[model samples]
Target: MSDDLPLTAEDVAEIAAILEHSGFRELDLSTRRFRLRVAKGDGAQDGLTQEWQWAGASGEIAADVAGVQADPAAICSPLPGTFYRSPQPGAPPFVNAGDTVGEETVIGIIETMKLMNPVHAGRSGTIAEIFITDGTLVTKGQALVRLA
Candidate 1:
């Protein structure tokens, strides 16, 4: 996370590690601009077992579970921010439903404070659905697109 951001990637990792080592089933944290919830799962419910990993050099948090593959169809936000489907006002969106995209394709952009971060597809697929409207606020790990 940026120094200006409320939470850092290390903060999230520490929280997750604490939750995983404790008897508590879940943890929820909230701030003026961000919210995070982590819960233990029993092999049911989509996204219930998501684990956070710290990207040391980049200061980014990745959602993953050991030995478990992430759902390829859903493209989620890396952090809490205002999501923008188009590059700018009155511009065409980066991708649309039925559009084929590569793993590194830029599907949308998330604006946090004044920093604009590009959101990638992460896996190659055809866009199936868009879950958020342009310029809507999105939370970290919130699904923004579904692939076919």
Candidate 2:
């Protein structure tokens, strides 16, 4: 129910039960820490197939249910935390869309457990997109920026 908390096994089961009663063939839910996919088996006779994946760990979507494209050149978060685009409030962001950056460029900062860790551009490239906004919670290995 909340973005900070991942769904438990029981929660998923309850959702599946609801889906079964509702006559929906499939359900895909993505939270900050996990992605849950449920689908009924073929022919509507077999039970549902449930798949759970850590959101940013494998960096793979079992099914592209949302139809969003993944950026191959994305700079991912090193750990789960709150992402900040600037050094401090009201400051200019480290990088913007179309900005050219080197491998060592400090693109942003991720605050985890009261520590601020700088997020770097792992490779040199022009900033193609900024996916996460300032001060948003991000999962480990979540795509923060895309390079062109």
Error of 1 at 58 (Å): 37
TM-score of each: 0.54, 0.54
lDDT by residue for model 2 (17-134), tens: 4554466888988887878889866853444567888856766433211112346799987655679999999999999999999999999998765668899998999999999999
lDDT of 1: 0.71
Where is model 1 poorest over a 10-residue stretch in terms of lDDT?
51-60
> What is residue 105's positional error in candidate 2, in angstroms?
0.2
Of candidate 2, the 10-residue stretch with the lowest lDDT total is 60-69
TM-score of 1: 0.54
Question: Model 1: runs farther than 4 Å from truth?
Answer: 1-72
TM-score for predicted model 2 compared with the true structure = 0.54
The number of clashing residue pairs in each candidate reads: 0, 0
